[model samples]
Target: MLRVKNPVLPGFHADPSILRVGNEYYIANSTFEWYPGVEIHRSRDMVTWEKVASPLSEKRLLDMDGALASCGIWAPCLSWSDGLFYLIYTNVRSWNAGAWKDTPNYLTTASSIEGPWSDPVYLNSSGFDPSLFHDDDGRKWLVNMEWDWRKTGSHQFSGILLQEYSTEQKALVGPIQKIYPGSEIGMVEGPHLYKKNGWYYIFAAEGGTSYEHAMSVGRSRCLTGPYEFHPHNPLLSSYGHPEIRLQKSGHASWCDTPDGRSYLAFLCGRPLPGTLDCVLGRETSIVELEWRDDWPYLKPAPGEELFPSGAVRNWPADSFEPPVVLDEYRKKGEFPPATKSIEYRFDGSAIHPDFKNLRTERDPEVYSLTSRPGFLSLRGGQSPVSHWGQSLLARRQTDFSFSAETKLEFAPTSFQHLAGLCWRYDETNQYLCALTFDENLGRVLKVLTFVDRQFMHYDPVPVPGDGPVWLGLTVQVDSGRFRYSPDGKTWRILRPVLSAAVLSDEFGGMGFTGAFTGMFCIDTLDYTARAYFESFKYTVL
Candidate 1:
């Protein structure tokens, strides 16, 4: 069952920040490492939205020379103050490095919703997820997730802090003081403070924005004093509810529906059975807000909402049917033509280029194939980031267990003309079960499962010798096993190692990652003599 409005927006959209100017509205989400930072979407009603401009489209604003997929952009908050709109976020060099180890927080502004935004003003590094909270007294507070890096057996850099903003200097005015740390409230990031019922309420994320995610709240009589975690905390979350389709629903920011009615807009990483992974990052979602006895609560009101069912049109009939499932190549009469083209979009990153989203830069001569022209092919990535340099025409891995099948023609050669399906999460994670060509050995199917920073090869299975060979994969995750096949029907099982990190919530964030997104995938060949997709298919088992 899918929500009609499920996925709201696709392709790595995350870290939603909304601002109401007049009758119209604007929302900004983090666009990490991608050349254009902070994508802005405009909407009149709470529903429909269209892309505007990246706040850092100007060269003076920010630079992302070596930004990784989930790094460059941090939590972004959008607010309109004094006829000016502001986008507040942190710019990190790379997630592989660690947050704030390099670039710090910054702010950019524009006059109109669509803008040539102003250059950035550096903010402080004691926090991330920089948000603008304009008080009634005309003072604007810049609150964010406080960052700490004390290594006491656990990983470094895990704590929350808060501070005040200096609009004149475009920086933090006073020394940042710790608001209640996330440990105190069972959450750690995306902190926002609002006033209701004479008490200051704090909304934060817990479980590090992944599968075990939740929206927690606490209140304080003072803005920067002792805060109390709600008795019924995780106000708007499915923390322990396995049935909820919304995974890692945190880093929340709240907006109102005019007339003073409040609502919350946050990003959610929708998990599919296969073909799509959470690494595509997060999608934006909306929920109503209400106050009980003066304290604010996230939508569905404490034990009252359905998982993945928060839409006006959530009936299965109203939603788009899921894509056709495919597991093998060469499926005789039951299959599509040998080749078809697909259309896709990219955030201008080296992984997924701006023009073609289907395929990305895999090697010097090829990129990952997307749906372009009539068929997708490899075009070498001019720009490279991490190990994603391999041309991969991939879609997100939605289901844990499913089959990915494709057709490729390989010429017997020494240099590997790589073609096949892959499961990827970031530069260091994932695996490839592929068809590699060798002059002597001919075309053969293989399985390579990567985990714990190690790529282990399973037994190589030979396929029938042909100019073009069929390749298929059965990556069954529910049982924690991955297999491969030559034809689309039969399969071979490979042993599994625990790859919890790829399936966890901490890795998801903006621009397909900020808070949630799909994993890196490719459908292109590297160092190819020539290869063709008779057809490509992914099926959820």
Candidate 2:
């Protein structure tokens, strides 16, 4: 047996929809408020995974212009049938509108996983987390959790709805039905259907997406019927077990290996020590499943008690061992030295796949790789706090301890034009070490930190000559600081250590995404101000 570590896909990879096609496995996750929506990863042996593609890469496929933080993409479901890959996702237009949630579902299909996915076909706005189920009889159905604003508390989640999808018509037809009203645990969502041995099984996430989150299942003899809840209910959950490293465990998708072994890919969160803040956001973890008496249960390791008395089995962080292992799988190896570091030279025709723009589409007016040939040219648009157009390009902060460095060249005539490296969680919470022109000092570097929407500015440090300056940020767990270098080697601390804890879900009120580190250019005076970034480097410490 090979011990596979938990959180196989770390750093903000949430709402995983796992599927196995032949020998390859693919997991699609939600990219909320980030452009190029869904993030998909590919795996061969279930233990090793790598980012393969982001299907929603064009403006025609996704348009989230003024979407608030964590309000663009939600629970994406990926499936395969009839030689085509089917992807169902929800475009959340409004989530903060008190009692109303304007969630519109859409579907897109492609013959290949890494593909030119077709334009999205509007599905419905009654709910979200929609999934397409291809029945063995050649009929396709869609299942999603219904949302009712009139209802209060958990009742707002309503029930799971089932409807027939006409592939030939490219639309949904026939009458819709409410299959399951959900269990006693409310806030039901992320529905997925599977059939085995004349039994129709429906899996869903319940108890909300917080600490009480869980994975529940129900089964019935018919496709849509009075489903019976699981004998123990919530087949997998980490609730009431704060000792466990993986918290907020729910929103799962299942798949079976070629050897008939069953596994689940679920979203989980890792909170900082002594706090409920998950700076890395919700990640993806895998757990094996066992079927007995036609019901599924989390399979525990030999002599290990799995969810004993509604409590999950605790594993020490130092041990780095999980409670379950995959039999006949190869031993897990350490990540390569090169895998810990990434250096983008900005010489390619397009930005690296690891980098993603905030909210808006990849407009050439805001950013261009060809404008400066060897450098990434960013034309500053709005201020960082604006929800609309902001020239910000960043990547996920995958490690608790890592460093990011970038070289920026910009001639700012006034303080309104700025460009630098940033550690951003959202518009309201971020630390920007920017370069701008001061009245007394020529071009200077200043560190601006925002905590819970409150702003704090540090003293400015003047630059020596008229040349490109190097800016860097290093984070070690809960604390981080900014630095600068003139020759790309010798560096000086630009600001005092600040709390990185603010860049988290708990600290950033109403936030669901994780922290990111990248380069940003802001010009409040005019949208035409340009800044050039020669290179950007990120390394895991």
**TM per prediction:** 0.64, 0.95
**lDDT of each residue in 305-396, candidate 1, tens digit only:** 42345422111111221122233311432333212233233322333222212212123245323423333455333211243343445554
- Off by more than 4 A, model 2: 153-155, 306-339
Model 1: lowest-lDDT 10 consecutive positions: 313-322
Q: Compared with the true structure, what per-residue lDDT tens digits does model 2 show for residues 375-447?
A: 9999987988898999999999888889999999999988998999999899889899999989899899999
lDDT of 1: 0.55
**Candidate 2: clashing pairs of residues:** none
Q: Candidate 2: what lDDT?
A: 0.86
